[model samples]
Target: MSERQVARATLVVGLLALTVLVVVLVPRDVVPGGPVTPAPVATVLSADEVERAETFSRWARTWSWSSLALSIVVACWFGLTARGRRLVERVPGPWWVQVPLAVAALVLLGRLVTLPCAVALQRLRLDSGLSRQAWTGFATDQLTTQGVAIVSTSVAVLVVVGSARRWPRAWPAVSGSLLAALVVLGSFAYPLLVEPALNDFEPLPDGPLRTQVLRLADEEGVHVDDVLVADASRRTTTLNAYVSGLGSTRRVVVYDNLLDSASRAETLSVVAHELAHARHRDVLTGTLLGAAGALAATGLLGLVLAAARRRGAPGPGEPGIVPLGLALVAVGSFLVLPLDNAVSRQLETRADVDAVRATGDPAPFVSLQRRLAVRSLADPTPPALSQLWFASHPGVLVRVAIADRVRAVPG
Candidate 1:
């Protein structure tokens, strides 16, 4: 088969595989008792609280969307134009050295363009009492994040460029498979390698809360190693908890703010939600689906770059392709965001269900949701499209309604 034909076939097959995995693995009807009808925001939150949430969300969303749009525009400018190619060509180095330098330059340039929006958002968070992090901390966090991005993207670009140079015709399939494997490896290693860079974690300590957490995990049939508390209070006042890693690295981490601010019952309610994720292996499911998505995106990228090459653009192995590759990835990730979030919402909702069921107490679950929304100043009634596109978890009102339904159902 022609190389073009092979690229097309790969794209089609990768997309089909991604679709099948989503259909089979994503939970549909995991919430028991009955369908949940979300209660009105006014029913739970005061008018003042709702107004504050709406205002915060409005400004936060504006800044967030502005940053995203600006980044895309900058990426396209650097990726598709003659000026961009000239910029990369001006760098004096071999392809190996030039690729990483070019990637860093383009990535940092994009960040520079969006830095104002980031600062604005951070200011908003500070004013709203959501973030406790100071300017120096924020700067440090941004650098750390960009450093990780540059390193990971450089490695990916090197592999792709290397593959193209080695096998002109089969690079798409080879690189796609390799990248897919890397996604799994990244998922497994993220908790160990990345989490430590941002915060310090200590065991939840021996106490009633620890005992209950362990006992609860036992009841849920998820293994209990230790619950770790993150030094999240240094960064933010918002309460949070999550289960991360896979297999041996698996851990349940709670924000220290949560332990200090919430009641034990409420804390257990959150732990139960995370335990549900562990019990169902949601992380593994997400990792596998992400690997498939990455492979599909690679195939799509191959086809697009091939088309560009026919139109006289640089070949895949050229340094000029670096910006274009990054731009394509940014655009592809944006386009697929809603679908990704849709699956995330389903999984999160399923976890919520398990949280209430395992705890067998809807009161704490309901209160916990309310407290989280209040603490985070979350808009209980967000715009429908925004929620559909970006919200990873079910809104607080819907979660409260789910708890109510579970409580109403006869045993």
Candidate 2:
């Protein structure tokens, strides 16, 4: 096949494989119990909580948009401007060293310019009583996050540089596969490596809750060995649960606060939601999508770089051009936010559906959704534009509405 045809076929096969994985991982039997029944919805929070939630949502949008604008401005400066290109030229080193340095400098520069907005958001969370972490802890967390970004960006740049140096004509093919592999590796390794660095995890104690969780997992066809709990209360009051890792590292994790505060029914609803993700092997599905996305992105990057070269821009292997590549990736990623969030919202909504099916009721699911919003001060009705591009899950009111429609279980 010609290279173009070959690239197209490879992309199609990779995406199909990911779709197959997603299909194979989910429990086919998971469905609405006795067809969803309508139930009366009652208030789950006090007037004070509702007021705080509204106030939080109001200014939160302003800060969030401000932060987004600043980040994009910085990305454009580093990617499109002569000044950013000059910064890289000022650094003296070999290609490998220079590329990593450029990646680091750009990453650091982005962080510096956006730090004020990040701090402002954190302050909002703390003041709103959502976060309990101290300033020192928050600052340390930021540094740690930046460190990870630097390492990840540096590795990606190095891979591109090496691939280009050795296989100029075939770099797109090789780098695409490599990027996909990197995404898969990170998905599998994140829980084991990166997550442990952020919080302590231990197996949930043997109790009625644990027994119920294990039983539910078995009922759902998920092979969960244990449920782990994170001490998330140390940082935030946000209640959450998730399934992470592939193979041996895979497990369901719940926030300790989830257990501490939620009723058995509410907690079980959360566990059921997480179990749906595990049953479907959502992590692997995500990895496959990541790989496919990488392939598509690498192909576009090739086209973009070629166009730049036609206009006398430095080639990929030339010194100080890594910033240009990083810039391309950043802008491309930013542009795809709406698409990403759409997929995420779909997955999340599916999990919500599964939880209702697994539990045979929707009251707890609805109640938990309400409490989550109140606890986190999430915006119930964010700007539609922002929700389309940025929200990873449906608005709380929407979730409650979905639950309210579920068929009431026979009394």
Candidate 3:
């Protein structure tokens, strides 16, 4: 079969898999009864609070958008121009060594370009009382994040180049399947490998809160072996919790700040929400979707690179393709942001519904949402475009409305 035919087959299979998974796994009617009407911002937040959140959000969006645009520009400049190819060709090594080095160079360049925006955003968080991390700790975190990105990208590039070199015409099918499997493997490994690098985690102590959390998990039919507390207060003041990993590795992780500041009920509200995610295997669903996406992206990349080669660009196995491949990935990720976030919002909403039903009380849930928004200085009503593109969870008002709707349902 021709390379184009193979690529087309891979793309179609990936799309079909992704579509079927979304339809089968994603929840449609999570909230009970009619459409929910969000509570007015004024009802929950004071005038001063609303103003502060809005001002912070505006600056936050500016910096975040600037960083994204700058990164894309840097990637495109290095990927689409002769300069990037020349840089890669000048590097002293074989394809294996040169490809990894080229990927590192491109990633580092993009990170450096966007450093100013990152600093500005961090400063904003600090000033708003959202972040308590010192500059040294912040710098360390940045380096750690960049290191992970470089390592992951280098591995992926090596696989692509190696596959293309070994199986030219069939590289797309081979690489796509390999990467998709890697995506699933990475999801399972993340809790074990990546979580430890960022924070110190300790098992939640034997206490009433722990017992209540375990009881909640039991009631929800989630098999939670232990609850872990992260030393998040070392870096930030936000209250949050999440369930991470697949199967045996899965555990509930809560912020220490939350344990210290929030009441028992409020803490359970948060944990219950996370337990809902676990009960529904939302993380697994997300991982499967991501794997499908990687497969589809690989096929599309193969097609585009084949076309580019005919127009004098580098072939798939060449070191010169590294920058172009990275650029395409950056653009594709940005383009898909809205769809990803939309799915995330739906899952989050379903979790909220389950949490409310599990607890059979909406007062603490409502209060918890308000407290989180106020403490984080989250805009109660973010701009529609921002919510569409970037917001993973629903807006504060929307979450509160979900609780209210649940409460209003006849018993």
Candidate 4:
């Protein structure tokens, strides 16, 4: 097959493979439950929790549909415009030229997609969690950080494309090599540079619960030195928590939204889920996987852009390149997000199991999960496909089932 055809086929296959891998990794069963704890403590939700949940639901509906519409429009435009035809018709260039352009286009496109969503997200009166700084930080954090890689790769793409008309056959090799080099360099730097920053939030205390959580981690042979509670409610009403940082900085963080809304049992359950990540080392695994996915997408798209440039098609302009990068990254990230979350859910499942295992009580975990489901208005039993693609935590029904199943036969 011709080089362009080959590049297109390769892109298709790689994306499909990644998507399949992500789908395959979705956790199907609960992990082994750990020690259980007693007491089904309940806590009342403040007005803030209710407000945030309501806001989140609205924002979710808006952004989800807004972007979905934008995607359809963009796709239709690409289709009607016969944009791909020019790339297809161009004589295949050297591997280097073709590859670099494609990668640059991909990276540029990936970065661009964030802008609209960021804008759409900002339009809402959502809380400021970490996302509060997303727009302003985009220049430094995402654009410049990952943006530089994208721009560098794009420049290489332009050179390849520029060389193609004069030296079509020579274009591919140069483009490919450049693309490869860019990907390799980016793989290492992106993580170190973009490691998630600790957003403004209240610090955790030297309280009993704090001590107990760490003590429990120690019992499981896990070293967890930091625990933080983020004022996530400032960003959005989304009820969420995550364990961020690496090695010594690794911390289990709770969303203030969760803290205020969840009962003590529910709050502990959230923390337990994060603890599972630390205990099972899922955080490290996720960080590595996320970085790898970014690299792979960057490389693949770079190749396509290189080809387009060689053919004299206007290399996707900054406007176009940015969106393309966003599309490709979103596709790649979405494909893997489920598996990433599934890995997380496995640890979470284990933590839930651990909660039971530690305290011989499953009720608290069950209650916590259920309350979250109701309060968050989460679709507890979404279609398997939807859940695989979107859920970051196990569904409430699944979590509750695990709790019930464990109670029937405790470890």
Number of clashing residue pairs in every model? Answer: 0, 7, 0, 60
What TM-score goes with each of the models?
A: 0.98, 0.90, 0.99, 0.59
Against the unseen true structure, what C-alpha lDDT does each candidate score? 0.89, 0.78, 0.91, 0.54
Per-residue alpha-carbon lDDT of candidate 4 for residues 1-411, written as tens digits (9 for 90 to 100)? 444544455445445645654455433445435433322222323445545545565566567656655654553334234453333334256544444554554444434664577566655532434244445543455455555565554554454445444444443434444444544444444434433442455567777777776776677676765777776664455577777666656667777777777666666666666676666666555544443444345446556566655764344332223334344444555456665666666656666666666545677777676566555545433556756666666666566666766777766
Candidate order by lDDT, highest to lowest? 3, 1, 2, 4
**Winner of 1 and 2 under lDDT:** 1
Candidate topping TM-score? 3
TM-score of 2: 0.90
Query: How big is the positional error of residue 328 in model 1, measured in Å on the Cα after superposition?
Result: 0.9
Per-residue C-alpha lDDT of model 2 across residues 1-411, encoded as one tens digit per residue: 433444455456555655665456433422235223222223555667767777987777778778777777787777776777788898887788787788788888888888887888888988888899999989888888888888888888788668868877667677778988999899888998889888899999998999999999999999986689999999999999999988888899999999998999999999999898887677777777788788777766766776787777777667556767877887788898987777777677778777887899888998889889888887665678888989988778767755655544322
- Judging by lDDT, tell me the better candidate of 3 and 4: 3
Candidate 1 lDDT at 275 equals 98
Model 3 lDDT per residue over 151-214, tens place: 8899888888899999999998999999999899898999899999999999999989898999
What lDDT is reached at residue 59 by model 3? 99
Q: Give me the overall lDDT of model 2.
A: 0.78
Clashing pairs in 3: none
